[model samples]
Target: MLAVPYPYLIARMRGLKRGNHNYYKTLRNYTHIVAGSPFAEKVMRQAYELTGTRIYKNTALPFAWDLLQEERQQQIRREFTNYFPQSEGKKIAALLVFGDISKMKKTPFRNVNMQELADSIGKDWFFVTNSQELAEASYVLPAEYRERFGFVNRIMPTQNLLYIADSLVTNNCRFAGSYAIRRKPVHVLRYTGNVFEKYVQEDYNDMYIGQIDKEMVKIQSGQMRPDQQAFCKEMSYDNPKEPYGVIGEILTKPF
Candidate 1:
């Protein structure tokens, strides 16, 4: 529906999200793709086979690191520690592998092999989800060798744990973008396997890990221009055009 009138809207910016039918349906019509993350770009490219000079002609711009402040993030992490054990030598890791409860078939949990991750990491692991009831269940574990997953009730507070922890392991869920935008590293799993690979994959695109680290290092070290943050906001060009571009191009170049 948005694709019908988005071009006429002044914003002219389109954001591709997870599990949304509209973005998938209108994939071919878009000329500029402002992906939530470069990982999304790979999914779209694999699913639709969009070429650089053809559809999505403009280079996709990443969404900014729009999240809570440092003090607030720390608060959430501290609260997380109350529920789980403390980290000794290695940093604790939080795993968020669940997605839309209404669509369980689409989640990576089905084939993720949780027991394997629990065995491999062999460290403090907190399994987070969007479900509240499950979170309560996680808290009351038998205090013995309980299930390998600890549960979190809220997404925001759970993500705050991400900031404090050393790493994150998620599927094609939106949280991957959280780590990406913040310049944090997240080890993505083979979420959803081939079921939705064309639409979403957890592979390492430069956006997810490599490039993000270097840029974040620059910001921390003050190697960036003083006005880099401000300049980034102004340089966000989404290749705007009249809504007619979708139709006009088809009519003009049917070949």
Candidate 2:
């Protein structure tokens, strides 16, 4: 069967033995394995050395491309505003795609004070985050600012909120790759997790939160421009064919 491993798995492979690890053995069973970016491909190659495993492709196919279209972005903005009316008059900033409280210990946001972040971000912005994240900080979050933070009880896909958000603040998760497509400013909290060195160093949109307000203003005002093309290159978006077309060719052809 074809396998499209998560980007993190590619990073983790760096710690595995060259040819003897169970994960590498399991990977051997797949007819084809895909890496979503050049950074991922490099890691996979280094980790899988002497194991007879190789990446079949490097393409970013899983991103929400349709959502980035202008018409769709407008529709999403309307839908988002309808659901969170507090966002109607204000610029929206989002904390994205985190799951359980226990899992957070592994990321840079583990020690971040969400209440302080909220207070420091100023009054012109409304914040969106998951319920669990809100609850994790709510006890300490002031009552007046609590209204500025909104969340849905049910599962709200990160892309919809991302489409309308003026900026994003997130840990180094795969979902943060959407910055390449969205071309917005993303303030990445610090963590030296297992990831490509170039991926962390070269991307223009990713930054620390030391002076978040000033950084945000610079980004929006074009003083700090993000190089979308450079970021896309890191994601291996160089293939001339559409990503779906490339995937289809791989699936239908002899392996």
Best by TM-score: 2
lDDT of 2 by residue, 152-239 (tens): 5464576567677777665544555555445566555333333432234434434544333334333333222345345445544454
Across 1-255, the per-residue lDDT of candidate 1 in tens digits comes to 111111111111222334322323335655545433333334455444333424332232221232324775667666665665443333455555443445455433333333443444453434444434434444444544244455565424555655565555554334544443344445444433322222222222322222221222222222223233222222222333333444354457644
The C-alpha stretches of model 2 lying farther than 4 A from their native spots are 1-7, 13-26, 29-34, 49-58, 97-99, 102-116, 131-147, 153-155, 190-233, 236-241
Against the true structure, what is each candidate's TM-score?
Answer: 0.42, 0.63
Error of 2 at 9 (Å): 3.4
Where does candidate 1 clash, by residue pair? none
**10 residues in a row with least lDDT, candidate 1:** 1-10
lDDT of 1: 0.39
Report clashes for each candidate as comma-separated counts.
0, 0
